[model samples]
Target: MTIAEGCILVACLLPIACAWIAKSKGFGKPRRDGGFDNHSPRQWLASLQGWQARANAAQLNSFETLPIFIAGVLVAEHQQASQPLLDALAMAFVAARAGYIGAYLADWANTRSILWTLGLACCIAMFFIG
Candidate 1:
């Protein structure tokens, strides 16, 4: 597989990492004691606060952005866009996403938004890469 395709896999997994960050504090404890309730995971996540809450929010945003990124890469590949350029954009998208997640966790709202926009731009650019 190409590096761009590999980036798609990494992009897909990022939300899981964010989810882990959101629920980490609740791990290894009983559900009744405010631990992560796998039985009602959504509810548990919804109850998060501060950086954890932001992490969950970022997870949702990551999931939301994934489809476009996937489509962008696939469409670019099918259109015979430059392989190296496609790979570079894909990598940039991932980097921007990582920055977004970090900014979210750190409560840097403006930085997070900027990174999010950069990621989206990368995806949009890929769509016309051919």
Candidate 2:
């Protein structure tokens, strides 16, 4: 597979890392009695505080971003675009996504949004290069 294709696999792993960190926060502990009942895992996660909550949000965001990234890679590949350029853009997407996770967890809303925009731009630019 091309580097762009490989980036999709790396993209898939990003959310798992976020979730692992979030889940670790409450492992083997009862859910704090928040508004939601602990009967469901979703409810339990909703009770996560501070960085854990941000991590969960980042995890969700990663899933939201993946399909667009996958589509971009597919388009670039299908169009027989410059392999080196596509690979560089794909790598940039991965790096931006990693930065997004950090920014989100750190509660840096402006940085997170900027990273999100950057990732989207990278994905969209791949289509144009094709």
Write the residue-wise lDDT of candidate 2 on 13-88 in tens digits.
9999998877785666554634333468676677779998999999999999998899998998999999999999
Count of backbone collisions in candidate 2: 0
Instruction: State each model's C-alpha RMSD to the native.
Output: 0.6, 2.6
> TM-score of model 2 relative to the true fold?
0.90
State the local distance difference test value for candidate 2. 0.89
Model 1, 22-45: lDDT tens digits are: 999999999999999999999889
Worst 10 residues of 1 by lDDT: 43-52
Runs of candidate 1 exceeding 4 Å displacement: none
lDDT of 1 at 28: 98
